[model samples]
Target chain A: MRSLDVTKTAFSNTLRSKMRTFLTVIAIVIGGFTLTVTSGLSAGINQTVDDMLAGYGEEDQLFVMQASAMGMGEDLGPGPQPYDPEAGQQSSTFGQEMLSETDIEFIEGIDGVTNVEPIFFVSPDYLETSGGEQYTLNSLDIPADGPAMELVVGELPERDAMEITIPDTWLTMLDADAEDYEDIDPQIALGETVEIGISNLAFEQETVQAEIVGVSTANLAGIGGAPMPSYALNDELYEIQNSGLDVEQPDAFIQAVVDVDDLEANEQAIKDALQEEGLVGMTLEDLLGIIQGIIDAVAWVLYGFALIALLAASFGIVNTLLMSVQERTREIGLMKALGMSSGKVFGLFSMEAVIIGLLGSVIGLAAGLAVGFTANTLLTGGDGPLGGVGGLTLFALDPVALGLIAAVILVIAFAAGTLPAARAAKKDPIEALRYE
Target chain B: MIIRKTESIIELFMKEGVMSTPVLETENLVKVYGRGPAAFHALKGLTFEIHRGESVAIVGKSGSGKSTLMHLLALLDEPTSGVVALDGKPVTKLKPKAVSGLRNATFGFVFQQFFLNPNQTVLENVTLPLKIAGISKSERNEHGMKALEQLEMADKAKNKATDLSGGQKQRVCIARALINNPEVIFADEPTGNLDSATSETVEDILFGLHRDHGITLVVVTHDEDLAAKCQRRLIMQDGHIVEEQTGASTTTPTAARVPAAPGERPQEQPSRRRRLMKFGKGGAR
Candidate 1:
């Protein structure tokens, strides 16, 4: 028979047994819905990583940190780690091991290294605004060639200038019950000077005043976190806080930044150079890879569950088509008697199966997309549950993903319909016509 | 159009007695069900021939193998042994595709049950065979409507088959049979489900196609009156032809075969015909 007639007949037959067809379709819907939601979640997490990682680090720069000899090859059967009272103190004074002038000069002398920047991390006692409001501050020196942090208001601090950039979360920290603010001018105006203090080991506080240069939308100071300081301000505070400690030259440095000639080609060479000094190399992509690997592993587990649902739905298709074949024995006989080839008979039944699959996938995909969109919106909207974290969505679906889902469903339905269709095709016309 | 031209040339050839081939013929046909101790023979070494434009009826009680013979001749079943030919071509061992091609092109069938698909409209039922023959949609509709019109079922083309009465359903079946314009039409107890009045109507339509369109008719039935109406009748008993008769008015011949008359060639005669009708003048030749 003609393909058009075969398809039309199969479609009409599908409608003839409405409840059975609907029930079969429901199985597929459940499977496809689960699959779609999980895929969307995977896409959403990947998109979030893309957004965050875009602003993470510079292409040609790597962070070099002192490798701890004590932690290497130490697999002390793990419970709560051995409480070392000096561990916290060591981390607190980590920046006091700042690279000396000679070390910096030595790093700058490396073959492929263009520049070397030493990071100075400092903890300030309190930030005092002109209005006399005092708040605790947590600060670090921003890297010179790192990804430019996205800003909500004002501009990045000028190089070698004592200016600080604060995150949006600092506003909430300042006032416990702050209203949702669109711009940050209410809490702290840009270009306004704020006094910061750091107490030296002598128990006397050293206070330094710096201008607020920019406000960032970074999640640096998330809920209950501390604010970030500009590179120059951090360096200035480091100088003022350690002056009375009698710490002239640091023994070891926490971290240093290296600029290389060819990032991809010279990365290993630079890493080797850093390793010679007992330091480790960490690039932006390596950090991103660690985060992505964790996310993808979780997503695959969720996808496996969706596949189980789809497998169950395929059985539903097989059962429905088998029943249809049994009921249409005489009709099939009549078609064969009318000179329909076995191949055409098979095509007719297969078309019916595919139509059922198409219906299920379409409905399932639409419903899945709707649910994904709503969940994404609720989680990522301004003032939504996940609103505090910048550039994060909970669910996402892409065109290619949708197409693959449909194709997978079609294949499953086709395979499930095969046995029943073969039965119908191989049926003897005489025996079928003789069937009561 | 090629089939029509071929039929016309065959008609002219028949007038000159050159290409007078039977539409279908079976030789030493055999069918057995199961094996060994359970074997039951359906057709035991029977041979028969059905000629073009000839209306022949095979009358018998149940299990006399009339239906078996019909199936073998229709190419719907494979004989355990023997050759079945259509238009002088051996078709018993032909490939499936070629057999289906011949079934679609050279024959149509009307069963006792009417056999119309209840899910389809009357028009769709009529066009089914044409669709299987790979005719285009537009031409299928045109030929289907023409065939339905011939059976006077054109007005009810859009109605579903279940909504039709028994006689109307049989007429629709006849229309479906005629849609492909086959050389032979098989009616297996076509009037068995109809009342006497409806049966007459169906009989008239079946005979009308045989008479007017020159389509060969093979009616398998147990109705003696219906069998007598055909120009020739074959009586079957114990899976073998017991008797043959020509016309209802003719006297019954004995079991002995008739001797060939002088100046008559046995090879030229397909099946028994009372008188040859003239061709190209709306008369059977």
Candidate 2:
């Protein structure tokens, strides 16, 4: 028979036993739903990582840190160590790991290194705005030339200026105790001037004024700080902390940024150059890999469970088609007696399986994506459960991946139908017709 | 219009002097089941030829192998060893696909059980073979409607097969068999499941098809009364034809020359109520 007629017959026949067909389809729906959710989760996290990494710096820019002498045996990078109670109330950098001026100059001299920006650790007592509001202050140095952080309002600081960018979260930190607090609007703080007090180790305090150039959102490259300062402000703060004090020279620097000529080709050579200087050169790829690896591992485990569900669903299809064949034995004999080829008989049953699979997958995908998007909206929408971290979707469905998943399920259904279809095809017309 | 055109064409063929060949012929047919210790010989070298426009019956008791011979002649089962031909062409060596093609194009069958799919409409059941033959939907309906009209079941074409009476179901089965316009019609106990009145109605239809359309009719039955209607009878014993008897019937050459239309009602049966229905009009086409 023609394929079109075969398909029509198969479609009509699938509706013969509605309950059995529905139960088989439900099995496939469960499998499809699980796969779509897991895939969407992985896609969402990967998208966030991509956006965050690109916003922070160039792909080749490396974050260099002093190699920890204590965690030297662990080659996975300068990992965190347990904090000792006796080592309480330490500054941002230890004496041994603090970067000196000479060490920064040495890092600048390395081959294949475009330039280096030293990260200065500054301790400030308080930040006082013009409105008489004051709070504890934290800040980090901005690179002279690299990708700049995205601003929620205003513009980035000009080069060689006493300009800074404060986090939108800084106001929240100041109002932590205020009941019924609202988020700090970025528009109110744009181009605002704030006086920051810097205190040296000798308990001498000096205040300096810096204008806020922009309101920036939280980023992964912030070094765990709230505001960002330009090179000039960092220099002035460093001087104020060290002035009129018999300060000891630091042995190591906390961190630095190393720009490369061709990051992909020269990253390893530059890393070796930095390692010789007792430093750890961390690429954005390395940090992103850590997040990506964990996400992928979890997604795969979920996918494994989904695959198990799909396997069970395939067997359900097999059983359903097999039973249908058994029920239609005499009908099959009649068809053959009417001159339908074995191939046509096989096509009829396989088409039934395909239609069932297609129906299940389309419904499952639609349901999954609907539920996924709803969950994402609940978690990522303004002031929702994940209100603090704005613009982070928890589930993202990729069209290509979803399409591939559907196609694979269709093939699996077709294969599962083969055994029953073959049995039907090979049936003896004489014997089948004789069957009651 | 189609019937008139086809009749004119058949008239043209008769004028061309192409005649006297058997519609189907079987020689030394053998059918064996199982092998060795369990071997059962169903047909032992049976040979027969059915001429065009002849109504013949193969009558036997249970286990007489009459059904096996019918299956072999209809190409529904392969003969273990023998030669069967359609229109004098050797067909025993034909491949399975070729056999299926021949069956669709040249033969039709009505079984004792009717074998109508209960879920389908009478129209769907009748046109199924045409669909298998890859006929277009419009043409399948066109031909299927004509076949149903001939069987006088066109009014019930849209009704479900399960809703039909025993006689009505058999008529629908006959409609399906005639939908392909096969050269021969094979009826195996066509009235086995019907009452005496329904059996007589079915008998009239079968004889009408043979007399009207010039379709060679082959009936396999145990009923001597059913066998008596045919022009010739072959009695089977064990696995071979034991006797061949020619019944009392006028051998009119004019009846073969001018084909009879099948919608004519028999004198003994009352006229059926017209259901005011038309095939392919409201049914699934």
Candidate 3:
């Protein structure tokens, strides 16, 4: 018989015992649904991390600090230790291990290090628009060569300019009479000037005027949606905050951003060199590796469950086909006697199994996508649970992964069908015809 | 020895001016059911030839090897030792694919049970042989409709096989058997499951196809009246053809001798006329 006829007949035959076929397909559907959803979740998280990293900084730059700055180092073996005079030099107002000018010079001399720029720690107390209300402000320094921020309305501030970019959340704060935050437009605040107040060493507040060059969208990265100041503006603020002190101001910073040549190939070498100098260096991939590993582990565990469900579903297919073969013994004999080849008979049953797999996977794909997109909408909405984490997408479908899942299910189903199909093919026409 | 006997019979037929060619010829065919001591010899060195356009009946009681011989002749089962030739070609040596191909193209069968796929429509049932032969759908439908029309069952083509009456089902079977335009039609107790009226209708259809189309007919039955309608009858008993007769004479004047074997049934058997009278009396009820 022609292959098309065999396939058509096999599809029709699957409908003979509708309930059994439906139950088997449901088993496969469960597996496909789980696999699709989990893979989508993994893809979404990895994509979100990548987007966040792009906004963080340049790929060829590493953030380096004293090894004990972030409480990540060898065990200190208890609370207190004998204090060395050099310990005092490592201390700063920022209450962390600070890098000094000498440390920057030392890093600049490293083999792959092209340049080092100290990340000036500046805390502006409040921000006030011209003739407008004052609002508490947390600020970050924008490096001269850093990656561009995800801007919502305007461009990033020019290098070495006394300019600032505020998050969209500060738009309403910039309005003096706006009762509703939604009524304030972000574009109006783009060119406005704001005063940044910083406390000096003598307990007096110093103010500096800076232009709002842009308005950026809030995201989980970018220092928790803080306003950003250009390197020139940050330097002026830091200088003013330390004036009128009796003690000499230590030329130290919390960390330094180091540029390197060929970050992909020399990142580990640069990091190891820094480690020998009692410092730690982290690349973009290094910061995201732990998160990626966790996501991958969770995806693999879910895939294991899906595979187990598919294994059980394969047995269901075998049982269903075996029963069908038993019931159709006489029919098989009649077809064989009518000159249908054994290969055709085998093809018929295998085709039936594949049809069942196709039905299950297609339905599962539709179901998974429906749930995935719906969850994405609900969770990413302003009033939803994940709204606090800006630009978070919980599920993203991968078309290639979906196709692979369906193909795997089909292969499993065909393998499961071979036993019963072989039995049907081997039936003796005489004995089968004589069967009651 | 059996070859000589078969040659003489063929010579006799030639003398009678039948002028027909033999479509199926078997030489010393033997069939055993089991191994060694447990074996049941179904056909013991039987030799026969069925000619083209001839209606031959293999009449015997149950377990008398008539069905076995028919299966062997139809290429449905392999014989223990013998040659079953179709159109002078030894088919037993052919591969299974070739054997099924020959059966599909050249032979048709009607069984005691209708063996129709109950869920399928009558047209689908009738066109099964053509479908197995990989004929195109449009052509299969055209040929199937024509066969159904010949059986006067065109209106029932769309009806499920299970919905048909016994006589109608038998007619559908005849339609199926005729759809392939086979050279020979093998009917094994074609009317065994029908009433007298239905059986008569079925018998008429079988004989009509034989008479009108000149398709060779091989029927296996225990009914003497059915056997009487055939051109020739071979009466089997215990794995051997005990008597052979033609429609022209009730007595077996050209009876083929049974080769003698030790520890077997006697060569001398009851008269063919007496057996016919006995079966005819029983069949009248």
lDDT (10s digit) by residue, model 1, range B1-285: 546534643553354322267777778777887899998877666666777788988766677778888888899989998788877767876666556666777788998888888877999889989888777888989998898888888999999999999999999999988887778899988888888899898998899888888888999887655776787777654566655666643346323242232343234333333321111111110
Clash pairs, model 1 backbone: none
* lDDT for B126 (candidate 2): 95
Best-to-worst ranking by lDDT: 3, 2, 1
**Model 1 stretches astray by more than 4 angstroms:** A53-57, A66-110, A138-148, A172-178, A182-188, A219-226, A240-244, A247-254, A272-279, A393-397, B1-19, B248-285
Question: Better model by lDDT, 1 or 2?
Answer: 2
Write down the worst ten-residue block by lDDT for model 1 chain B: B276-285
Model 3 ranges off by over 4 Å? A43-59, A63-103, A120-148, A170-172, A175-183, A191-211, A220-224, A233-255, A261-294, A381-397, B1-21, B248-255, B260-267, B271-285
TM-score per model (chain B) = 0.82, 0.80, 0.87
Off-target runs (Cα >4 Å) in candidate 2 are A53-60, A66-107, A122-148, A157-159, A172-184, A195-199, A202-208, A219-225, A236-247, A262-286, B1-19, B248-285
Per-model TM-score versus the true fold? 0.85, 0.84, 0.83
Candidate 3 lDDT tens digits, A1-436: 7777788788888987899999999999998888889888888888777876766656888889888886765567998966755556767655687888788989999988898889878877899889767888755644442353557677777768989888777777777588754467878988899999988889799899999988775554444367888888889999988886888866777888888999888988988888988899987666666677889999999999999999999999999999999999999998888777788888888889898888888887788888887897888777676764656778897888888988998998899899989989999988899888
Q: Tens digit of lDDT per residue, candidate 2, span A182-285?
A: 45566767667888888876878888888887766554334313577777887788878767668663433456777888889888887888778766787877
Q: Largest DockQ belongs to which candidate?
A: 3
Candidate 1, residues A216-242, lDDT tens digits: the string is: 664422311234565777777777766
